[model samples]
Target: MVKHLIDEQINLNLLTPEKTLFTGEVSMVVIPAEEGELGVLPKHAPFATTLRAGEVKIYHNDNVSDVFTISGGFAEIVNNKCEIVADGILL
Candidate 1:
């Protein structure tokens, strides 16, 4: 069970051409995609994916949470970190 568990920290960065909109650490992330929603956790497999215009849910420590609407963008998950480069972002 311990070996199967991914017990690493995760950070998310939501950015646009103008500036970075949101940046924080979280336990999980849910992104809207063309096919369906994708969930990511710590130490997840490296991936580069397209994100659809929808809500991006972030689950932080202490049960805190935040949601943002992204028009469209790309998401990359690697080395326990997730970075999102989007065109439009609204919180």
Candidate 2:
């Protein structure tokens, strides 16, 4: 199906070994990478990175939608989809 520019979204999945924390569509996400905070938007290039202990911010409709605190983890982005495998989640 064809999608309009304004309707574009990225599938975000935040998960831990025990359970899934968040799974939905979002406009953007900010992750704490090894280097620093990394902002991920729709159509972002595919890559993987190790996350630092920090907050994961999910954005939608130009506003912050959800936030997750992780002790550390791994994140991967591919084809407008982002998945985070957290080692430990605080909330």
Candidate 3:
């Protein structure tokens, strides 16, 4: 059996006690950072960083996509997986 790769998009609410904003597969993701925007792709290195209030771009395939704004939060990357825990999210 072959182990398939699974890509996931994670969103959360910081204000709420426990709220899952969004979770699914995405072609690409752009995270807003203090320095600027950061792009994430498959097999990305393990990383952890803080996010600023700004637009988060979610790319599905080539033409399909969506954008959301996050107040603030933390993001972690490990094992080719990306996880984002945010305060507030708006799309």
Model 1 — TM-score against the truth?
0.82
How do the residues 41-72 of candidate 2 rate in per-residue lDDT, one tens digit apiece?
88889999999999999988678978999999
Q: Which ten residues in a row have the lowest lDDT in candidate 1?
A: 1-10
Residue pairs with colliding backbones in model 2 are none
| Model 3 lDDT tens row, 12-49 | 22232367655776656788876788887666777789
Model 1 agreement with the true structure over 1-91: per-residue lDDT tens digits: 1333334458899888999877877777888876789888778899999988998888754343878898989999998889998879765
| Models ranked on TM-score | 2, 1, 3
How are the candidates ranked when ordered by lDDT, highest leading?
2, 1, 3
Distance from true location, Cα of 74 in model 1, Å: 0.4
RMSD in order of candidates: 3.1, 3.7, 5.5
Point out where model 1 deviates above 4 Å.
1-8, 61-64
lDDT of 1 at 66: 78
Q: State which candidate, 1 or 2, has the greater TM-score.
A: 2
Off by over 4 Å in 2: 1-6
Candidate 3's C-alpha runs over 4 A off are 1-17
Distance from true location, Cα of 90 in model 2, Å = 1.8
